[model samples]
Target: MDKETEQLIEKAGKVYSENFSMTTCFERAIFFSWWCGINDCGFCFMSALPKEKTAKETAIRHESSILAETWLCRKLGWEFGFFTGGINAFNADKIESMLEKINKVYGEKVWISLGPIPKKLLERYKPYVKGVVGSVETINEDVHKKACPSKPINPYLKMFETANEIGMKTAMTLIIGLGETKDDFDKLVNFIKKYHISKIHIYGLIPHKGTVYSDADIPSAEYQAWWIAKTRIEFPRIDIQCGIWSDRIERTSLLLKAGANSISKLPVFRKFGTKISYDLEEQTKLAGREFLGSLTKMPEIDFDEIDRFGFDEELTVKIKDKIKKYLNVMKKN
Candidate 1:
């Protein structure tokens, strides 16, 4: 990173420390409710996903698996159940049913990322969810339309508007390397001003194979930090989550300094198995922030936390047994 961006990041860190205090929480748990849904987003990897894995053509992840993933995420100390899937007709009802079950078990730990549902549906989910999030990737109408083709920015803004009107917290996800303009960033500020979005998730776009930009360059980490820092400088109070995968968890320290309060996509699996190199707690601790759960270490399956973060006694026993077996099996491996 350049000196100027470094200074800005430092400034953002100070602002974050002053306003929110520096605590990084791995609160996001992305449960892919469906997969391989057809999308017009030229940059998305789903477009390249095979027919069998795609939602519209083949099968979606089972509801049991979906619920299991949520339970495991909550148990692993993630704070929100972020339900996202490919665009399809069957998604709405299935998501509503899953939300009902999750609401009963986890109580307002839901956030839906399914694209552009009706206003009434958003209202229906209010009782079951903490908030709703959408990818308002960019407010550059023409840029969004040209790249997404079918998925425009307005519909997501409408969803966000409904979320705000219904008193649910709102967040928008934006990709940094998608030909975003300076004016686009300016519009994002106005967008948060207009819609009152409480959080913004930023990622550097990594071009996917079989897509139009398959051969495009990946945005450097410094570029990612630049935008994240800029955002923190702009909205010092807004929650900023820097997107990371299992491979790049070490970036947690850098992002924390760049003013990101959280990072994305922990290594939690459907059956609660994780395969990763970085130690999440240590990484966040080195960043001078705290992580909510032990990322690599499994705790003693405490009953108190089970009641607080997991399901009822019967289900908890089943889950606990499974976890123990899984750990033992890993030990042998």
Candidate 2:
């Protein structure tokens, strides 16, 4: 990691471990990731399409490991879920079989995160699953395309409509930074409000390895917090969470202060198949109260935990420097 990122992680540790020590929640939810087999979602490590692998090869190379890992996590008391790649590779029978096998192994813990597939397909799997997560990623269409080119053109609108019509509980995700303006944030919040989405997750862009967006810029800390705080003002009733809390705990707390009621806990998916390391339940225990207090039936969280490490000043300085470096490089290029 770079110097700036190291500083951020250090600050995150202090905030979560030293302050806001309270309840555990992120582990109570299922783990989901961008499982692409249709489109190589340039932002994820597992972006290889299923078609890119042969049928027997895919089943052998990919399926068994994931199945075994899911079963193991379930056995350890965590639900397992998968987000499909893209709508272009939509195959009903294939999905049904995958879920069927998942049910056989893990039973009633599977959640699909595909774009609005045909309604009939969703109806068929409704009985066997918990719920579907429609991670719009961002409500800004231009940003959406720029970030996830392989995604459907109007995924945000269409999926919002479908989730409402289907009456299935929905989890909508938003990625912050990505060069979106405050006006864009307002629009995204309104979109969420109109749909009455059950859960809304906010994520900051973590430019991944071996991707075009690897060098993409992250927003200013103040800007990120501003939008999140604004989101709290927009949807007070919905279950708002800062997705991937393990990625940045301070940011998670800021988003919670802004309006999100929860943080999507870490150990989201197993790396290199079926191996376990990060214990989300234990991590949650150490991750402070500002985050945990927002969960269902918990008392209103006091925002004092924000001061544990005096993070506001140091974090602001570090992020500003990083953002400036990125902007200068972008200009030069």
Candidate 3:
């Protein structure tokens, strides 16, 4: 709110425009594979320890949904699948089959970030995935251990090193307002610098029922904006994405101005039939940026590129027919 801080944030905004050549905070699509995982994270809202509760929804999911969702992401003019949750040793076969099929169509537009996978296991995914994520909520080891008792930070560091070594893009996830101090922020920047990390997905802690911090306060819009701008100022070329949570949806536009290139987790797959965050859309407009916030208006469908991949006839036809029908309905509307 002060002049100096305001001016710095403005500078960060300019850096984004200068580097990316766009004021648009593009809405990237990221849906989950949430089914089975050891939910030892006190801050986690989804999934549980296997024996603690049901632990997950189910291991077996419709594989066809993978192709359909990937196509849907393309139709909406967004990035390919970035999956998280599930895909563990217990139920790797079914998930691997789906991702393998996805690789043939979408190629390297995928990344998975639920947790660290061993070097051998991660390499296998390298063929289909373009990037991998290491969750580094805080560089302060004390804070990290207290917050995530079961999750270790060193493996994520190793994961980053391996990902870079193997010629894959390296990304990270960090939750703001995890009781991290100002010094921890500096450590975070240093960690990124050391690892040559490319992208960061910043999440605000939103308390959820049945979690340890269910009554925790969500980070303020101003705090979120300040940190994001600081990160952008430090790493102008780094890909920064601020999360938009429904709980604190009011912070939407301010977050964009803080130098996040996109509101990267929009549940955009739901934008097909279900309504999207029109409020967040309004916020983007307020920030003078564009995002796909409605299904009524559609982007130009690139059929040639779609056909060029030589995907299965059955899957291809299914997606195309769906698109055609949707387009027709849009035309009528």
Error of 2 at 137 (Å): 1.7
lDDT string for model 2 (1-333, tens) is: 345444444454343333333333443342222334444555554544244444323333233434444444444444343434444344677667667656765656466766665567768877666667786777777777776777764654565566568776667767777667778966876776777776666667767666666788766545655555555545544555565544454454444334444445454442211111223333344434422321212122222322332334654344334434433433332
Clashing pairs for model 1 are: 36-54, 36-55
Instruction: lDDT for model 3, please.
Output: 0.68
Candidate 3 RMSD to the real structure: 4.1
CA lDDT of every candidate: 0.69, 0.52, 0.68
TM-score of each: 0.84, 0.62, 0.82
* Regions of model 2 farther than 4 Å from truth: 1-24, 27-42, 46-63, 79-90, 101-110, 220-223, 245-333
Error of 2 at 235 (Å): 1.7
Model 1, runs deviating above 4 Å? 52-58, 89-91, 270-280, 302-333
Candidate 2 at 288: error in angstroms? Answer: 4.9
Better of 1 and 3 by lDDT: 1
Better of 1 and 2 by TM-score: 1
lDDT per residue as tens, model 3, 1-333: 788778878988888777875554444444434454555577775533344444444543344445555655556555542666543523555546656766765555577774777778777777777688787777778878877887878878888888888888888888877787656778878888999888888888867677777778888877788888889999999988888664565787777787887776554434433334556667778877766434335666686666666767776776566656555654554
lDDT of 1 by residue, 217-303 (tens): 777677777778888888888988887765566666878888888777554432133445236566788878866764565545454
Best by lDDT: 1
